[model samples]
Target chain A: MRELEERIRREGRVLGTDVLKVDNFLNHQVDPKLMVALGHEFAMRFADAGVTKVLTVESSGIAPAVFTALDLDVPMVFARKRKSITLSADNYTADVYSFTKQETNHIIVDKRFIQPKDSVLIIDDFLANGQAAQGMMEIITAAGANLVGAGIVIEKTFQKGRQLLNEANVRVESLARIEDFVNGQVVFANED
Target chain B: MRELEERIRREGRVLGTDVLKVDNFLNHQVDPKLMVALGHEFAMRFADAGVTKVLTVESSGIAPAVFTALDLDVPMVFARKRKSITLSADNYTADVYSFTKQETNHIIVDKRFIQPKDSVLIIDDFLANGQAAQGMMEIITAAGANLVGAGIVIEKTFQKGRQLLNEANVRVESLARIEDFVNGQVVFANED
Candidate 1:
């Protein structure tokens, strides 16, 4: 966790007040070693939660989810934003509003993937508004699966995404929680 | 490779002419153990290629790309179709046509991710008509990097994807090459 905070301090780019671009190691480009370490950390943190499956949204969330799933020795499932002809007709879906893209897209998980007997953990890169995590939680509820918690790489606490998930009775464990960006520096909640 | 072939033969579903869905493991819901095995196989095949980076498009490609990058001990980069506010403006992009989606979308990679000193290996879930691979190849070319080859999980050989990449002088190594789905059974090129 300290290493992730250090990497964010070193490589994360803060644009305006909310956007933290981790170009050098997370999102877009990735360090696989770092990803593996993150996965191990998540597994270590939530080992007793009885997680049977790892869930995430497509694109940016897939890498960490895969590594986490591997560390947990469980199956990984990702919700899709883009509709594919090859995808089945039966699915559980929820709308996620992205402030970055300035749009709401329907994120879907095939009904066949999630089961009532499974315990699911949601993983992702960043949690800003918590819209994506909330959407994934809805999918988990729809499938009748037990929601363990969310494992996020970075959470912008100022954006109040943590409050959103906590209100929904969802536990969030972010490796790095950014309290604010002051003078082009990332400030962590626990640092000072 | 044998295990992959077995998985495709067992779990892969044939919907129509070319729609082979491995919903149980490959896409949608994924088996991390199988993915790790597939990654190891790909690494074994391209072990001597001097791969500096592993490149793939986002969503479905990210899982295998992560595993492949871990096995190769290199960083991974995924091209994005959805625009994000955090994403940098300077990018190298290419238009990729998705036959399943019946649309062409622009895929982008940040200019700083891929460099001239890099030797990129494109990894993906499938190679149908190879448009995605071609688009990724263009991104590698834009960076002035050497393209080692494409490591594909599955290839519908009848679709002539192999021919296209071969014509472009890019080597392709598919774990399972489908000759065709005969009588609802996946037929491999080497089996016959």
Candidate 2:
């Protein structure tokens, strides 16, 4: 977690009060070494949750989900934003509101992938307003699967995402939680 | 490669004549162990190329791209399907035609991540008509980067993807190359 926070401090850019750009090593361009470390941290945090699978949305969430799946020795299921022709009709879907994109899009997963007895660990790159996490939970609930918890690499604590997930009784673990951003200076939630 | 071929034969569904769905392991639902193995194989194939980065498009391509980056000990840069608030104005954009979706989408990569001197290794889940790979090549060229080759998990030999890529002088290494799918049976290309 310290390594992630340090990396964010060194490479992260603050665009506005609401946006943090970490494309250098987090989302668009991924640092696989750091990703593996983050995955190990997630596995350590949720080691006893009986996680059968790791679930995430397309694009940005795939990296962390893959690393966590490797650490937990479980399979990872990513919900596709657009349903291609190759996708089967037997799928569980939920419309997720993207705060950044300012639109709602359906994210889907095959029904056969997530069984009723499985416990899924949801992971993502950023947790802003918790819309994506909520949508993933909806997909899990639709499949009659259990939501183990949510693992986030970077979280904006000033936003209501954490509150929303907590109110829904979902345990959330974030590597770096941003308390506030004032004049391009990031204030950590728990400054060590 | 044998493991991947076996997975496709067992879990892959053949839809009509040209579609082979291996979402269970390759794309939608990813097996991290198998993905890592495929990544290792890619590393072996492109070991002499001096790959500095792993490039791919979003969604399905991110999984194998991550693993390939891990194997190559480099960073993975994935082109986003759409422009978001997080994406900057300075980017190399290319239009990709999706045969399955029957539409053209613009894939963009931030200019800051990929430099002119970087040697890139492109990875993808499938190479059907080579449209996506061609688009990625355009981005790499625009950035003045060297494309070492393409590492594909599955290639439909019956399609013109390989031939098109070869015509473009792009080296392609596919783990499983399908020669034909006759009467619900998969015929693999002769391995060297």
Candidate 3:
């Protein structure tokens, strides 16, 4: 967790007021060693949750989630994002609105992957508005699966996403929690 | 590689004539241990290539590619797929046509991640039509980076993708070379 926060402080760029660009090591261009560390941390944090499956959104979440799943010795399932919704019987779908892109996309998970007997853990890159996490929670509920908790790589604590998850009684754990972006610099929470 | 072949035989769904749905392990619901094995195999195959970086497209390619990069001790860069193209000066973009989806999407790579002195190794989930690989090659070329080779998880030998890469004189290593799907069964290229 310290390594992640250090990497984020060193390599992450602050864009505008709230956008933190981690393309160098977290998102677009990934540091696999760092991802492994992050994944191990997440697995260590949720070691006793009875997690049978790791769920995440496609693209950005795949790298960290896969490693987490590997350490947990469980299957990792990524929900596909579709710009246009096509109603399907085989999948449990939820609508996720991206505040940055300003568009609504449907996140879908195959019904066969998540079962009623399974315990699911959600992993994601960033927890901003919590729309994506909320969507995954919806899919997990629809599949009759038990939600263990969420493991976030970088969380914006100033945003309303944490509040939303807390309201739903979802246990959320983030490696790096950002309190605010002050004058083109990141101010992490609980950092003296 | 035998382990991967065994997985394909057991869980892979041969859909129609040319489509092989590996959503169970390689794509959607991923088996993390299998991915780690596949990634280790790829890393071993390209061990002597002096690979400074690993590149792949987003979503499906991220899991295997990240592990491959980890084993190789390099950075893994995933090209972002955009349905609508927005030309930018800071990124190298290439158009990749998905034969299955019947749509053309742009794959964008940041210019900062790829350097002219870097030797890049492209890794992907499938090598069917080779459009994604070709696009990555184009971006690597545009960036003035040296391409060592490509490591493919599954290759359809019957498809034109292999031929295209052959003509381009790029060395390719596929873990599982699928010859054909005969009556809903996968036929390996070099089965004894």
Q: What is the lDDT of residue A24 in candidate 3?
A: 95
Collision pairs in model 2? none
**CA-RMSD of model 2:** 2.3
Candidate 1 deviant stretches above 4 angstroms: A83-89, B82-89
Off by over 4 Å in 2: A83-89, B83-89
Clashes of each: 0, 0, 0
Comparing 1 and 3 on DockQ, the stronger one: 3
Task: List fnat per candidate, in order.
Answer: 0.91, 0.97, 0.95
Candidate number achieving the greatest TM-score relative to the actual structure? 3
Candidate 1 residue lDDT tens string, A1-192: 999999989888989877889977888898988988898999988899999999999878877888899999999998888442244569888888888978788888889889999999999999999999999998899899999999999999989689999998888999999999998889998987
lDDT of 2 by residue, B37-90 (tens): 988999899989999999999888888888889989999999988633244569
What stretches of model 3 exceed 4 Å from their correct place? none
Each candidate: chain B TM-score: 0.95, 0.94, 0.98
DockQ of each candidate relative to the true complex? 0.83, 0.87, 0.95
State residue A79's C-alpha deviation in candidate 1, in Å: 0.4
What is the C-alpha lDDT profile of model 3 across A1-192, one tens digit per residue?
A: 788888888999999999999999989999999988989999999999999999999989999999999999999999999988778899999999999999999999989999999899999999999999999999999999999999999999999999999999999999999999988888999787
